[model samples]
Target: MSQLDPYGNQTPNRAPDSWVPDPWLDQPDREPAGEWPTRNGRADEPYTGSGDLPYSEAEAQTAAYPQVQPRAEADAEPATDPVRPRRPGPGKRRATGRAGRNLPAAIGVGVTLGAVVIASLFVWRPAFLAVIVVALGVAIWEMSRAVRAVGAHPPAVPLAAGGLVTIGMAWYAGEDALMLGFLVTLLATLVWRLADGLSGFGRDAAAATLIAVYVPFLGGFAALLAEPDDGARRVIVTLAAVVLSDTGGYVAGVFFGKRPMAPTISPKKSWEGLAGSLVATAVGSAILLYLLLDVEPWWGAVFGLALSIASVLGDLAESMLKRDLGIKDMSNLLPGHGGLMDRLDSILFALPTAYLLLAVFT
Candidate 1:
């Protein structure tokens, strides 16, 4: 016998025990007809076995309805749509912290720099001055470019020329000449920016003056340190103490840093790392001062403590400046170290501090 289905198509009626399997039913991947909308706009109810159906109720349900998934399996499925964005896997994201840097390259560059500095200090003091001049020039150039990125047009020519004069005067002439060089530089900067019209003259002149003071003016103290007898030892002690602070901070920060020092400006710095720097710098400076300069251990500790704090301040200050300027590094001139300014920042801040303390105590 043949009967009409809900869709008005003919459906065969056979003995329940002798019915053959439908082709659609054999393919479990396809949705069953009962799930489709009917003429009344409702999904057809589960097939419990209609009056004219040839199959038993269990067979009807099994062949015409989807099976209920287990509770665990259903819960295990993803809640979000497959098309939505997901968190990047490890391979997709940047590696951070110590693991992210090229440690070997950084170490190599550091060692090479240290060797050059030590040799310059020992060979001839004036040679060291030349090195400082070259470094300050690069640092000034970097600072000029960085400030210019933010619409400030610091005159690099005057800044560099004045820096050479300032540093050379501090070395050969004295403190008075250093002051004169700085004043002249500031004047030149003001005059140079005036040539560009008064549009941003003050802003441009201010930036150039800051570069002069921040880089060459402070750096002149290094030349002063080299002027005294046993000057090389003093310079070495200062450089060594700062290096020890940085090294200790890096090591401790990588292993044990928990709380951020300044999350907004410098996310990587930590109070614990600062403590490490202080302790290491204090001990290292004390030993160097006592053995080399014949200074009392206590005074050396004081000097070290002061320099460590100054270095920290310098680091944070540069971090704030970079954040304001929207830059990661001043430049990528140095493969692992970022730029001359990045490496010089701490040293520049520490230089005057070291010089004054040594003069007072020794």
Candidate 2:
């Protein structure tokens, strides 16, 4: 009996079910009090460890789990796979193509503008002048920005101010009034630049004066057309002829444009395109005179030749400005057309030529 009950041969201190008792509460009298606490649903098993937070089996199990990283962050890091170097290529650009990426939008805007101008011409004529004046103001603003890129800070405010006055004078008082107003605007522009002191006065004043005269002064001719008899018809015919010329030029240039016309100024422009334009202009002028304005076809031919030559000069003038400033377009506002400056280039010269021809004929 003493051999079996020896102190060295003690049995494992466990429950009758072979569950090893917690080593913490080693007293033989104390059983696991909250070990199987399912019925009461609350285990108030006080942690006897040196921690402020009470130990919970559920919390401990949750904290013990391994954490997984998100794929988004993993992907954001530099890729591990071998990368093939990109070959040397063309310079990065926001847009490309001859016409434009947003051609539909461009066409829609152009159509809308044409509709608005025609509606204004007969219904409320002064509104047409107002629209033109506003457009000139925007052009003045764009010109200032372009010149600024080339280190000239022109006073756009005075220039815009003068443009509005010049347009208004041309509409009410005629060509003489337009000239007087333009002179006043240039004087005002020069005076306005005085406020800027001696710094860049010459360049700024000159630029402001130019902006006022070039856009608004030349544009005043179109307003003068509104003063003559059947003015709306005259303006419409002029617009139609110019538009036809531009269209013909574009069509010819695209298909049969092998040789450049003035490669130094505009590489895309071709002599073939100019020839097409002259043909279209001649036809359009005859129709405008005989059917629309009741003028002789011979006179129309003369007008076509003069206006076509002027139109080429007009386009080249704008291109020269762009080339000098080292810019491709004045603005990206007109989508496929470029900017207001680009659209008005041909029309600016055409309007003046038409006015001069009309004065001679009358």
Candidate 3:
């Protein structure tokens, strides 16, 4: 057998003809056991001889084992690792698919129910109007709540007094009496504002008073629709025209709306919808007049056109009020809809116009 030299070279003293060099030790530049080159070139190899270097028994054991790479370094190897999955954010969970469908369904149901109730009031006049009166009062309270929410301090005394007076005059008095009551309420609002030392008193008072009259006072005409003779028919026909107009506008707007009708006031409205509303109202009113009132188709067309235009203005007026107050809806009293004020907003102008027309022509 051949003996190996310190550098693993074959020695001639022992069986040099039969010597077999170890493959690992045969490489001259390769590091030996317990030996590694120093990074700073201070030491070429680790000293394993007795007392040749300061090292503990554990360090000696570690030196005998192979060094392992850190987990971070191992993980960075692209072939051995899979990509991490991304986590979802908070907003991702709040996405809803039913909002669009649900909103329209809610509005449709609410309007149908409201129309049914209004029609019933025509059958049971006293009881129905009483309910409407109570509803109006509640609506006023809701408006007051909304006003306060936007940081406006309204005079409660004048608001309540004006609301009651308006309701009373509407119930018992004629048109002149109703107008006089409105004037009195306006004066009361001003006085109350002055007593409270509130700034923007004029504007606030005017707004509050108008809200009462616009919501309930105009609603009083629904009661007058039940008068004997053809009065009820005329009122019902007018209401039918308004309803048809609204339905036409909503359907057309959804399908063919292109140009905005009133972008600043109502962003969703379209000229297409407005035109549809006018045509539908005119046609519907003509049919009602021919069938119910024995009136000429031309007269019906004129009334319908006028009422449809008025309804658009009514809608815009309410939009302006809501925009000024920084509110989207008046109240959430009605499911999927808003408060009585919201439902009655379009009817407000329509009712008064119908009443005036009837007073003059009928």
Candidate 4:
């Protein structure tokens, strides 16, 4: 019940609120209208009591607000409240395991491919050669597309044609013809790049030659394996050994692979997985060779060990290539498996190794 200050707040010696009526409501007289007061007779400058304010520059800046820091209790909520569950990753539901692949699709595709290989291989020799041709063609096409990213325009047509000739020579003609055909293909690839002009001739020719060697040259050994009367069995044993190695590695990598083998190249690969591959390959090779080729079981072990090491190297080499090319997969043609090249990576290395081993053992 006191009179107020200018802002309508009660002061120590003020009269009661009832005694002091509102000035704006009670007063009748008004001052004559005039221009508003300004600092230094300039409207831009706001008035300060003493001349120009010393902190005018600082005052011109917007007021800094203190950031609202998060509460410690909120961060500690997850630890204390056992009922609140953490969110899972996006792929956790669909992925089969830590590898993050659709396991069902991968297995189905693998079985189908294996069945096709066996059917063609045993049914007719020409049919198996046709299969090889088709696989190499697709691989070359994929590489052609992949290399374009690096400005290397490998001629896919000549590459495919040369691959056909190479595989045909290896299967029908003999080992000498195989060498002759490879040299011819290499020369053909060099000449093929000439049509594209000399802009990137060296680069393009190099890539094309690499494709020729990697795809068909290595694949010719498979044809070599199938040349003998008992050739089909030899090829089968080689395929089984490589497949077992991959399977054993995959299983072991999933369960016991804590230490990475080549983390920079393939993060999923581990030393423990490699151990599994060697054991599986060796054991499987021994059984298959003894049963099919009438060879000693120990020879099979030697063959398996060699093929396993080569297969791992092949896998790592392709991984390095893909990493260099800045691609995850050569193509998405094969769901769950990635590309034909991906499937053939280990096979390419294993084929030559198997051929060499069989030549020595048998």
Each prediction's TM-score versus the true structure: 0.74, 0.72, 0.70, 0.75
Q: What is the lDDT of residue 169 in candidate 2?
A: 91
For 31-69, candidate 1 gives per-residue lDDT tens digits of 576765454454543443333332344456777888888
Q: Which stretches of candidate 3 lie over 4 Å from their true place?
A: 1-112, 115-122, 198-200, 223-228
Worst 10 residues of 1 by lDDT: 46-55
Residues 1-362, candidate 3, lDDT per residue (tens digit)?
A: 45667686766667656556655556445456346554444444444343345344445778899898899987695675677887787754433212232465466766776676667556765665566567677777777777775566666567666766666676566566666766777677678778867677766776676665776567666555544456557667877878888888888887899999789989888999999999999998888887887778888887888889888888888888899888878887775556767766787789888877656655
Whole-model lDDT, model 1: 0.85
- The weakest ten consecutive residues by lDDT in model 2 span 1-10
Tell me how far the alpha carbon of residue 252 in candidate 4 is from the true structure, in angstroms, after superposition: 1.7
- Highest TM-score, which number? 4
Give the Å shift of residue 185 in candidate 1.
Answer: 0.9
Higher lDDT: candidate 3 or 4? 4
lDDT of 3 at 358: 59
Clashes of each: 0, 0, 0, 1
lDDT over C-alpha atoms for residue 58 of model 3: 48
Off by over 4 Å in 4: 1-95
By TM-score: ranked, best first:
4, 1, 2, 3
Q: What's the CA error at residue 77 for candidate 3, in Å?
A: 12
The list of candidate 1 runs beyond 4 A from truth reads: 1-99
| Model 3: number of backbone collisions | 0
Tens-digit lDDT track for model 2 on 139-251?
88788888887788877777888788889999999978999999988887788778879899988877787687679988888899877768888788778778878877888
What range of 10 consecutive residues in model 4 has the weakest lDDT sum?
Answer: 42-51
